[model samples]
Target: MLKPTIISLLMASQLVFSQKKPATTYKYGYNGMELIVKNNKETIIVSTFNSKKAIKDEIALKIYDMYTKKLFVNGDLLTISGNEAKVIGKVSIRKKGNLVLLDFYYDEIQWKTGLVEAYED
Candidate 1:
């Protein structure tokens, strides 16, 4: 009886200490663009972004151009990282009439994709 009780206590301690917690998610949106950050721990964080702008803002246009050049021409995945998080992902661009849409994916699970209305520049 004492041996069985000891074994059960050890098993409970192991179960409590060996479990990993799920990651926390955060999101930010600006001018039809959305950014997501997932933090699994203090050292491991991932980020992804999606943009579907009307080409109205200069900053948005510049970011779109950079992503287009990098993803389409270089065939490379974009890396967006900071002091708190690090993200490596792919960008997909599509055009419908005059509007351009950008979709970013940081894994098979986290991503966003769509189209937006176009505006005269």
Candidate 2:
């Protein structure tokens, strides 16, 4: 009985700590332009390739939400095609008054090909 009770408690805690499911999703031709909806009330989209019309935009997207009382983790999204092998660091994408600033880190890297276009789905 005690073992089952402990298992149930662990499962409940796991659910409480899991990341919230995305309320809505964005399908875009860019790898890092996923529409970020916060509080289910605000939708934020960073311009791809410094332009909202930039299709086939290649980018590097960092995801993290670690935070403390004073320190907030930064999840920066950047487009790689802007430099096309010229810029080895994070690049800025500004368009339609939207800006996605980035900082490059070489400590750890992972490449994915989930490029998409900006649109609600």
Candidate 3:
């Protein structure tokens, strides 16, 4: 009886430890040039890299601009040419006159391609 109870307790403890915590959720900013979202105690690039066209159309675009080193909100749909990438979240960009930003993601293949292309001729 005692052995069985001990084993059950051990199993329950393991179960609790093995369960992963849920990813954290973040709210979109209304009208801002940059925003940051955090998950699991880490800062992942949730959105960045908006183009100029998005601003003209007033459509919400999430982008991470490598040149600016900051996130921006634009007005365009995030597009990935290949099947490896998908939108991780629904991003919103607040409209305020002529300024705009677009949201984008670096999918697994897109990310890998960048690495490979950087070293290629």
lDDT of each: 0.41, 0.33, 0.35
Cα shift from native, residue 48, model 1 (Å): 5.4
For 2-112, candidate 3 gives per-residue lDDT tens digits of 999999999999999998554323233223334454445444333332212223122222243321344423433343332322222223444334433334422111222
Task: Give the lDDT of residue 115 in candidate 2.
Answer: 29
Q: How does residue 45 of candidate 2 score in lDDT?
A: 45
Q: In what order do the candidates fall by TM-score, top score first? A: 1, 3, 2
Which stretches in model 2 have alpha-carbon errors above 4 Å? 25-76, 79-121
> What residue pairs clash in candidate 2, if any at all?
27-117, 28-116, 28-117, 28-118, 29-116, 29-117, 30-116
- lDDT string for model 1 (2-117, tens) is 99999999999999989754443433222334432223422211122422132113323333546535535323565543232334446565545544455554421112221112
Worst 10 residues of 3 by lDDT: 112-121
Query: Model 3 off-target regions past 4 Å?
Result: 29-121
How well is each residue in 1-121 modelled by candidate 2, as lDDT tens digits?
Answer: 8999999999999998895533222343223453342344333343333223322223232211211121223443333343322112233322233433332322111222322223342
Native-referenced Cα lDDT, model 2: 0.33
**Model 1 vs truth, CA RMSD:** 14.6
Weakest 10 consecutive residues of candidate 1 by summed lDDT: 112-121
